[model samples]
Target: MACVVALLAAGCSAHATEAGPEITAGPDGVSISIPVQVTVGGMPAGDQVRVWARTYDRRGQLWESSGEFVTDGVGRVDVSTAPSTGGTYTGVDPHGLFWSMRLPENEQAPYPLMDADDVVVLLGVDRAGTTVARTTLRRVVREPAGQVLPIAEAGLVGDLYLPPGAGMWPGVLLLGGAEGGRPDPAYAALLASQGYVVFGLAYFGVPGLPTTLARIPLEYGLSAARWLAERPEVSGDRIGVVGTAKGAEYGLVLASTEPSRFAAVVAHVPSDLVWPGLGGPAGTQTSSWTRGGADVPFLRSLPARGASSAAPNQAIRSADAYERAVATASRWRLAVARIPVEQITAPVLFTSGDADGMWPSTAQAQRALETITEAGNPYGSALLDFPGAGHLVGGVPDLPTTRTAIPYGPVTIESGGDPATTAAAVRNTFSATVELLRKAMPRGRG
Candidate 1:
């Protein structure tokens, strides 16, 4: 919480004593939470001062947040405890969470600031939108230290990121969701920089692979892990898998099928039951994966609910629609679709958003925890539930808190969540995941 601000009057003749805000680091010492405090001297005592922050991602996309505060008797404002009545959202919680990494109301694309090198710009403006003062705060972690390379082997296509060092590192097999293409390398790069040999695995939708998610082979994931383990920079016996959304379902099934290959498992927005594979026709229900050439058991899709005529708001991904879909499915969806958590020998960590628009991830995570508890496994498992967040969790840090309408096959789906809460959940879960991996698969143990 070290102050990093310089005080200077912008357009006003006021003498301001500006001490920059404190950027608090989460447990992993990479992600950050801000508690801002601004003080101004010799200004109109009750005038309003607007506080805002701006930063850019590696791709040069801008991210920003702004809130207005009324000066106190001495002309000072505290963002850590102020009641936010305007800006991107309205709330009473202090800490400026409302403005941090939030997606603008009409914005179609929101790129988050990732990595420690990306600086956070802080600004103070008058009620007239004139700048009163400004400063910059550095992120917690240092620049990522890793080497990224493209790799295609045994039908797996993606990138590999190795931490900068000589000895073998613990390996992590990274998988993205049903987005059909190579997984984003940013996450793998970040984890590799933090100390791992991360292989961003793409099983389908790339060259030499199936174009859609229909009946893909689970063996591909297993082969990728085996290949990663065989690498000179990776520890074969100390390996883990990190998966999101659809990828999480694959991770659970894969870990269950090959228990000895993994020492740790991190599944975000996970499912306890097998789901029908996506990337098929809009409403078509079919097996998403297979093993030994046989289709895996999967839940059937219920009739989809049309968009509400009252609201006609396509931007809001209807949680009710997804909930109804799951509810109307046959009872077999629960019995036959259940993941075999009892077979997984590795320690497990599951994170979910309670307000996820895509599916009932929170409930599924709870069921998985219950099933694992019943199994009485000595390895143990844990779940992190985030309130007011959506299905998107765990990936590159500083991405938009919300996606308005991202394409989900033939339909453009919106992820529902409180932007601030979603951002915080992602960051905290990432740090927790790193800690879990280090403990379960400590360096040099393999």
Candidate 2:
């Protein structure tokens, strides 16, 4: 370690100032462990690291528990990202491990790895990674309290999060943002922190899964809610879904359609109308794709106009393809899910980003959300937009690795803040949302 390396501040932002770290993948057959040596210039920081790593199969079904582990000295740790099965092993280590699920390979959804993935390490905050408070996660990731009873339907492959202790805890199904692809522990950590048993499961991953909007279904989400309620530790009847981005539409689907499953929801950066998908640019100004940042330019690498052009292709259908696919399930686009805002039966807290540039339904989502409140539906609806947030929970500025903005937003950011901070805020918001539900539907609780 160099005695003198530059650092930004004791605190960190998404933008990092390091030359990026090295993530080396292990051997072939077995799921490889990628060693991550985390540092902040001159500072040593492995003692304060927490790791959460998960990889999904080809059908978008999440394969395993994202390991939430601690690091050794030298501020380094290994996250096991590859599934036990065969495939290319591409693992990732999150900042807090609370939210470090980046889409790997040519994968928009996560998958098991057999070969090694081309690794790129992006630096954010410039400060050393924080060691998780030993008891911090134990407070949430423990066994359910009381006895976990069976709900109406606790079927196979359901994604669920259970909070510390149990019995009638506020519960929610966490939708992992748009595309339902990224690893979003933020929502789970947040809601669970606030005594909400939250299951933030992956819906899209693997190779054969139907990732398109038209083919996506809410049956999985519905069942998860019902199953959570049945848990002896859970007040399943009080279940809610916290949907973000495209997941917001799913949240609406649960609350409006399966009104019984979800008691209420706090949708962050939600889409009023579901389309193919929408997301913020992978602003990597400070990092380099050529070096070790995000490898795929994807849409994020395109100019704002080019990136924004996808809006017209909402259903992921071109003029001709739309006409062709319209006859089949692929084009009917369940993505354009109808919430019937006029008759919305569940309580909802709708949040959007003021600075998000990704939206095929930017105008439409705002209007559709507004229409619900205007209708005076029995449901409770409130909209909150971050001061300058893009699509993420942290209110960090929109910048790539090399061109990150010096943030001016409050430390308690509304948009994309750091992962732990984002989790904390979400937890607080979930607590408030639970209170609102308790008021609206007394029986909704245990």
Candidate 3:
């Protein structure tokens, strides 16, 4: 119907209100009565309520449902889904009525759900039986952990195939290209087969989550990581992160910025900086890298505000601004480089293609790798070189695509980065991540 979120307002809640309807939910949906009183600015309405929520996915963000849940004269509402479904659903009404739903299950917990972000059970009301109260589900999901947490937070939104008793299998977080993370990609099943729990995420697409890089938060990645650390089945100390392209940027940010959170980081065809770079003086450096060299420009552009010169979409989607964007990225990324490798104490596996078209120089990655190893961090760090792959690789000698963490290296690379091989790499990313976790575990280390 309409936005029930506005009806509730800040500091107000459907469950908290004395006159609020008694909304009951079952497996199919939520059921509530009529005369829904929605309060906004101390103003109350009888129908049509909506809220905003944040859902998460593998790559970064999930999605948000706009205008969900309605109300009736009886102050009752209903929903089509169950709270037991995955994803953390937090609702805020117009007046700021807030309520969050946490599912009882996790990704490796034998649940059929794939992503928690995917499930949206609209909350509604009868509307005095005159009109239907409607609202959108605006959601926001933050994934700080670059590894297993993505699947548990975002992947559980749908029906995924994690095996029973898979509770402690080492898990990995696989990052995708600039698009967004989806749990159903061919990789999910493959990772499950690898005997590890996985959490693929979509930090951008989730309703309340920012769809663009400008909207993404540094803490979002941190939160996911901490969630993984606190889990009982998973080896919190042993978690790992695997990233590709922009996801690689995030991986680098997470692994380097929060060194203790991850056991190791597998950065596939990765570049270091976070934003586009301008050439070095007419400028030569064009991108963020293997994590080094170049003076990364400060991306002061409030592009996410739809105002700046470096809007995430403009810098990423519109090639018209490629030259300008690269100049800007150069400034922002170099600054990020100064963040200290000591801070990134985790071991790192940097994979890159000598022939990548995505960047102006492959040498930057080489340098970044050197920096990672030279930092003398407590973890292992190595740069895996593939022959012909580009920014994303794991396939043949021709145009190296991807092979991030799940192995299958040159063989899979040789198959034109075959789906089977790609899938294998995805699984291997998780498996190796789990192995990394095991190795990091105090007992495993001893």
lDDT of 3 by residue, 122-229 (tens): 343333333233343332111212132224343222222342353555545555545454533434444444444455555554555544443355466666666555
Query: Which candidate number maximizes TM-score?
Result: 1
- Give lDDT tens digits, candidate 1, residues 295-394: 8988765533554332333644545654675677777666787789889998999999998887788988898988988989678689999999877777
Per-residue accuracy of model 2 over 123-238 as CA lDDT, tens digit each: 22212344322211111122234122212223423234454453456666766543344334433443454466666555554233334333345566566667666766566466
Order of all candidates by TM-score, from best down to worst? 1, 2, 3
Worst 10 residues of 3 by lDDT: 405-414
Candidate 1 ranges beyond 4 A from true positions: 1-46, 57-61, 71-78, 89-106, 110-124, 137-144, 281-284, 307-333, 396-398
Better of 2 and 3 by TM-score: 2
Evaluated against the true structure, the overall lDDT of model 1 is 0.71
- TM-scores vs. true structure, each candidate: 0.82, 0.47, 0.45
Q: Rate the local accuracy (lDDT) of all candidates.
A: 0.71, 0.41, 0.41
Candidate 2 has its poorest 10 consecutive residues by lDDT at 395-404
Model 3 residue runs over 4 Å out of place are: 1-167, 276-339, 394-446
Q: Clashing residue pairs, candidate 1?
A: 5-20, 112-398, 277-288
